[model samples]
Target: MRVRRLKWAEEFLGSAEVVVQSPQDIKGNWNTYMNRECIHLEIGSGKGDYWIKMSDMYPDIGWIGMERNESVAAYAVKKSEEAKENRKFIQNEAMHLLDYFDKEIDAIHLNFSDPWPKKRTTKRRLSHGNFTSIYKQILKDDGELHMKTDNSALFEYSVVNILKEGFSIEELCVDFRRETHDEDAISEYEQKFMNKGNPIYRAVFKKVKEEN
Candidate 1:
């Protein structure tokens, strides 16, 4: 269902507008949110649950949650307004990633991105090298891509893709739930799957050097 135009939300976001329309606009005057040169991104943020918590936890850094769906995006916007000073939610797709971020992003988060199980639809996966390449273009030299998922097949494919794409896989775990995950902020789907004892897979890929 579509959400009504929230006047409060519009005012809240307009007051703390950090979103950019193109990569070209990312540079210059970035100290609007935090004095430090750092930014974090969460792709496919479903309900802004994790985003709200993270923004509350980390005040010195900026958080941007991107969700293409309008209703879902509104949900994030509502949460962001509650902590309007540090977090922002964008209603858009991940394909336009470069448009919103600059080269100073400290980290990128891909929490349970679409599996895209079929071989033919592999390119659509966020973990695909093509997306990774785009991510590298806007990420800082030593930035990290933190990813988590419960899909085993997709996890395996991501590992292969990251390696083939020439990125260094610093940390990887087949079952994130087996061990106590401290930074685990439960997402809308994560809570539902936790009851089933689903094993969540995770990996942190760091861009070591430019790919030729």
Candidate 2:
């Protein structure tokens, strides 16, 4: 999906308070910037609605939105600034997450990530074994990962990959609204899917210690 480039997006993102020019500067010191203990990361944060809302909902926790597209990321950064939330937007791809962050995240939110359904592109999925390995490195030993999607195939694939990577599934819901409505955070894409009567699948996986 090619995002339409906004004329002032570059300028806006550069000056946006929530936009991080170089995440490497913060590295493992993210808590210092937010002055908070719990930090959560949202991968493929499209327009930042979910994380921005989450920041408002959970003031005690710091939020980080990661996106590769500058145009959409600009909107997220601007929104975070306007909300005065403890949230930051990083304009970078999820694959290089380790390059910017160390073992600093308490939880990860994967909301409406790309399915990458093709067999050849399976490795590109956010929940793939390769990406899960990277996530483990940057996440705490007991860190949790929450994923929501409308694609059942992608959800199933993610379940298999997540378990294969040694994470235990704590919660699984084929219809998130029915199973976990109270805890659900509706994102832009999630709202669209819900309006169309699509059932959302959600899962929470926690990292468990491996026995020697």
- lDDT, residue 141, model 1: 84
Clashes of each: 0, 0
Give lDDT per model, in order.
0.74, 0.86
TM-score of each: 0.83, 0.93
Which candidate has the highest TM-score of all?
A: 2
Error of 2 at 57 (Å): 0.5
Error of 1 at 209 (Å): 2.4
Q: In candidate 2, residue 46 scores what lDDT?
A: 86
Where does candidate 2 stray beyond 4 Å?
A: 81-85
1-212 in candidate 2: lDDT tens per residue? 35789889988878777788889988989888878898999999988889888888888898988988888887777766674457778888888888888988999999999998889998888898888998888888799999999999999999998999989999998987865565557877888999999999989999877577
lDDT of 1 by residue, 96-196 (tens): 87765667677888888878899899998988877888788777888888888888898888888877875788999887788776666777677677778
